[model samples]
Target: MEKERKVFGISWNVFLLGLVSFLNDMSSEMIAPIVPAYLTEVLKVGKLAGGSIMGLIESASSLFKVVFGYFSDRFRKRKVFVFTGYALSTVAKGALAFTQGWLDFLALRLLDRTGKGIRTAPRDALIAESSNGKTGKSFGFHRMMDTLGAVAGPLIAVLLLGLLSYLPKEVLYRRIFLISAVPGIISLIIIALFVKDRGGEVKKKIAGVSSLRSRSLQLFLAVVALGTLGRYSYAFTLWKAEELGYTVLQGSAFYALFNLIYALSAYPIGVYSDRVSKKALIGAGFLLSALASICFAFAQSLPLLVVAFILYGLHMAVMDTVPRAYMAELAGEGEKGTVIGAYHTVVGVFAFPASLIAGYLWNTYSLTYSFLFASAMAFLAFILLQFD
Candidate 1:
C-alpha cells in the first residue's frame, strides 16, 4: 500500500516562508505591546490620534495591496515586490526608534503598513500555489510560525522592560525599538536567500468590477468586505485592558495569552477545515468573533476579558487560515495572486474605515459601542455567507 503524505508537514518553501513570517511577527509583536503605551504615555498622543494613525496604517496597507497585487499579476513578478516590501518595513522599524512625534510615528507606520500591503497578497499567493491541495495546512503552518513570533515578541518586550526598569522611560522604549530591528533584518535576509519567484500559474476572472465579471469572486469579495467592515483594530483590546485597570505589563500578558491560543489553534483548525467545509469554518469564525467582541464589551475584569480574548484568538486562527484557503479554492489557477490581492485590498479598504469608525465610536460613544458595532458587522457578514 502507498504511504499517505504527512499531514502536519509543510513544503520547504512554506516552511521558509513561515520562518520569515515568524521572524517578522517577532519584530512586530515586540512593538505591538508597547505601541499603545508609547503613544499615550511617552508621545502624549490622544486616543483619537492613536486610533486614526492605526486606521490609516491599515488602510494604506490595503491600498498598496491593490496596486502591488495587480502589478505583480500583470507583470508576472512577485519576488521584487516582496523583497522591496520587506526592505521598506525594515527601514520603517529602524526609523521608529528615532520618531520625534505623532506625525513621525504616523509616517513610519504608514510606510511599514505599505510594506505589509505590498507583500501580503503575493506572499499568500506563493504559499497557496506551493502547497497544492493543502491550502489550509499551508496557511495554518504559516500562521503558526507567525504567532510563535507574536508570542515571543511580547515576551521579549516585557523582559526588556523589566531588565531596564532602572532606565528612564524614553531610554527604555528607544532601546526596545532599536532591538526590534534585529528580526526585521533576519527576515529580509531569509526572503532574499530563499523564496524564488514561481511565476505565471494562470489567469482567472476577478469579481469586484462589473467589467471584470467573475460572479462568485465578486460575491466572495463583497462578503469579505462586509465582514471586515466591523473588524476593528486589535489595539482596542489592549486599550480596553488598560481602561479596565490592567497595568501595561498585565495587558501585555493578556495580549500574549491571546497569541498563544491563536498560535496553537491555527494548525488544528486548518487541518480540520481540510476535512470539513471551509465555508462553515469561515461562518463560524465570524460568529465567534461577534460573541467574543460582545463579551469584551461587557467584560468588567481582566479575567473575564481574558476569556473574551481567548475566544478572539480562536476567531483569529479560523479567519486567518480558512478564509484565504477558501479564496484559493474559489479562484482558478494562474489568477490566485490577483484574486487574493483584490480580496485583501477590498477587505483592507473596509478595515480602514472599520478601524476609523471604531475610533469614532470609542471617542464619542463607548468602547462597548465600538465592539457592538463590530459584532453587528460580523453577523451581517456571516448572514451574507449563507448565499455562498
Candidate 2:
C-alpha cells in the first residue's frame, strides 16, 4: 500500500480541509463583525431584536449538527454533506445583497447557518480521522488557518470600506456581502478538487446514543453548556467598540485584531495541550474569559478595551481548538462525528438563551450588567471544571 502523504505533520485531507475552512471563514467573518451594525443601522432593528436575531443565526446550524452527523456516519459519507453545506452557504451569502428587510436577512442567515450545521460534524470527523494520533496539533493547525482567514476578513472589509468611500454606506455593505461569496465559491472548488472522502465503517448500532451514559462526557458537556451560556455574540464586542466612539471601520479593525491573536496563539496552545492537561487549559480559558468580561464591563479607555479583546482572543484560542480535540479523544472508533455533533448541539442550544439574556440585560439594565452576567457565568463554569 502507498504511504499517505502529510503536510505540516498532518494528512493531506486535514491540510485541504484547513484550506477550505480558511477560505470559507474569510467569507463568513466579512459579515460576522458587521452584522450587528447592519441590523441596527441598516435594517433599523433594536438592540434586543438584533441580539435575538444574532443568537438564532448562531444556533440555527447547530440544530442540524447531530442529525447530519448521524447521517454522515450511517451513510458512511463525508464529502457530500461538506460540499452541499458549503454550496448552500455560498448561495445564501451572495443573496444577502438583495435582502430588503430584517426578515429577509434572517432567512438568508439561517440558510447560511444550516449549511454550517450540515458540514461541521462530518468535516470535523474527517479531521479527527486524519490526525494520526496528533489530534491537538491537527486541530490546532486547522484552527490557526481558519482564524487567519478571520483576521484577513475584517481587514478586507476595512479596506473595501475605505476604497469604496464614495458609495453610500448601505450600498457599500451590500457590495461587500456580494463579494464575500467569491471566497466561498473558491473554497467549494478546493473541496471538490482536493478533499477526499474518508468515511468510517458502518456500525450495527450507533455509538453516539450510548456515549450519553459516560459520566465524564456528561460532566464535560455540562461544563461546555455553562461556558457557552456565558459566551455572548461577538457582535457585542463590536458594539462595545462603537460605544467607545470608534467608527465601523475601526471596530472591524478591532475584530481583526482579536482574530489575529487567536490565529497566532491557537497552534502553540493546541500543541501544548497535547503535552499537558487539557482540563487545566480549559479551566484557564474560562478564567481568562471571565477576566475579559470583567474588563469589558469596566473599560473606560481604548487601551483597556484592547486588553480585554486580547484576553478574549486567548480564551477563544483555548476554548475553540482544545475542546474539539478533547471530544475527538473521547469518541469511540466510529462515532467521532456524532460525539462532536453533540458538543456542537449543546453549545448551540445554550447560545440562544445566553445571547437573549445578554441582550435583555443590555436593554433592561445596562451594558455593564450584561458583561457582569457573562463574567459570573464564566466564573461559575471555571469552578465547575474543578469538579470534573
**Would you estimate the TM-scores of all the predictions?**
0.93, 0.97
lDDT accuracy of residue 93 in candidate 1: 80
Every candidate's CA RMSD: 3.2, 1.4
- What C-alpha lDDT values do all the predictions have? 0.83, 0.89
Clashes by residue pair, model 1: 202-334, 207-218
Would you list the clashing residue pairs of candidate 2? none
Error of 2 at 131 (Å): 0.6
* lDDT for each residue of candidate 2 in 88-204, tens digit (9 for 90 to 100): 999999899999999999999999999999999999988887777888898899999999999989999998989998999789889999999999999999998988877743345
Error of 2 at 45 (Å): 0.3
Residue 216 alpha-carbon offset, candidate 2, angstroms:
1.3
